[model samples]
Target chain A: DAGITQSPRHKVTETGTPVTLRCHQTENHRYMYWYRQDPGHGLRLIHYSYGVKDTDKGEVSDGYSVSRSKTEDFLLTLESATSSQTSVYFCAISDSYGTRGYNEQFFGPGTRLTVL
Target chain B: SQQGEEDPQALSIQEGENATMNCSYKTSINNLQWYRQNSGRGLVHLILIRSNEREKHSGRLRVTLDTSKKSSSLLITASRAADTASYFCAQPGTGTGNQFYFGTGTSLTVIP
Candidate 1:
């Protein structure tokens, strides 16, 4: 596996509450991504970080935020949880993208979050 | 918005039969990749086919890309029960740097 681990593998939080999920990697990869998987929606990117303190929004950035203060850690926070935010969140790491060869992303186990 | 859409949302086949899934996408792409996800697990990278390449194989998995049609297909030969999972195709969005857009996915059930 890709030496990636997600904390709080399963969680249930009430609506309007704050929640944060953590992704820690040991591969020292330059790219880290957060995605949410829902039925009929596949996996939608929530946020991603290219380097320390360098982050960008993805296709489904609403109601979510991310931060990467170190190369090994990436965090996803739901400012105020909602029923629609309930889904399986996955964290991925990649060495490079759009480069000459090598664009495969290694994924972590995943985190299942439920909003009541 | 999702860039890729997979056909036959669900599939069922015998253990020894072959399994094929098709993905159609909008917009240009540099490459297309396939992934598998078991129940309650993260996605596992299966294979990738570049836009310039027509076909590529890895073990029993073969991927074909047709840029003219903007589509791709994945074939798994002699499928086994272990191959039962949801398969998805992904590609980077146009003008988006390092971001991947995934399809809704096809759920496969290989009967033993």
Candidate 2:
């Protein structure tokens, strides 16, 4: 199994507070992604990094931002938390040599955030 | 806004029974993959089927993809209580990047 870990497994905060979730990987993979899961909705992409310092937004990147200064760490930040932002967040890393496809993603244990 | 949708939002089955989950995508994909998730945890990659391939298997898990119909199905045979988890289908976006669009997921319950 790939070595991936997510920090701050659970958190609860005020509506306007700022929250940061961290994803760390030991696999030295080139691709890293952040996603959120909610009831009745698929896992939606928030942000992703293809290389160090290279990141892009996804379908639901409205209130979130990400930064990757190193190959092993990807950080996700919510500038101002809202009730709608409360969901289980996941971090994933993909390698090109996995199998049939050029890239296959492996996920880290998620972080559960609740904005009260 | 979702690229893929899974059928049968939830399923409950007895141990030793078969559980089949289906997923459908809206766009052209390079490959489709399946994942499993325990409650409030990260997803685990189960299998991947390429656009040109029709079927693949790993142990008791069988996956079938119909690119013409833009659909795929995951079958877990002889289910056990340990097989209880949420299943999701992911379609890799068309490009060099590694972004994956996921389905809503089907929650499975295996009653022992």
Candidate 3:
């Protein structure tokens, strides 16, 4: 798991409720990412952070927001949970960016969030 | 959008048989990586091959990269039941960003 941990390993929430997932890393990597894994979709990046308080949207950033006040923690927030948001979420960390030719990423155990 | 697509979504083989999975990606990339995911768990890094390299090996795993064909293949020799899991290939996006897109993955079921 690369010393990365996600909070609320499993959660069941109601629709229209707000949910937040936390990712913490001990490696002090430069990059952190949030991704969702669904059937037929391997893993879709929701958001990523390059440094403290530096965040960016990913391909599937809509309906999701992220905050990175510190280097080791990145939070993904769903303003309003929906049934479609019920999926396994994973957190990943990398020592360097892919464009820099360092592309190895380590993933967390994942958090299973279910919306009713 | 996904940068890579894996062929043969599912595979089944005997313990002693070999399994090969292929991945095709769009656009140029600096490197490609393979990962394995067990049911209900996070992925584990397997091997990484750079664009400048043709083939790379690690233990029983062999990976080949064909930049000319925009494809790569992962071959697992002497399969085992414990090897049953989903395998995915990932590559950095074409743009200058750091995002890495993953393929749909191939589910391998190794029979004991």
Q: Which portions of model 2 show Cα errors greater than 4 Å? A: A97-100
Q: Output the lDDT of residue B52, model 1.
A: 85
Which TM-score values does chain B get in all models? 0.95, 0.95, 0.95
Q: In candidate 2, what are the lDDT values of residues B1-112, reduced to their tens digit?
A: 6568998999999999999999999898778999999876688889988888899999999999999899999999999999999999998885445789999999999999
Estimate the lDDT of model 3: 0.91
Better of 1 and 2 by DockQ: 2
Chain A (alone) TM-scores for all candidate structures:
0.95, 0.94, 0.94
Go through the candidates in order and give the clash count of each: 0, 0, 0
Off by over 4 Å in 1: A97-100, B94-97
How much is the lDDT of residue A16 in candidate 2?
Answer: 94
Question: Distance (Å) between predicted and true CA of B79, model 2?
Answer: 1.0
Query: Worst lDDT window (10 residues) for model 3 chain A?
Result: A95-104
DockQ of 2: 0.72
Ranking by DockQ: 2, 3, 1
DockQ: which candidate is best?
2
Instruction: Score each candidate by Cα lDDT.
Output: 0.90, 0.91, 0.91
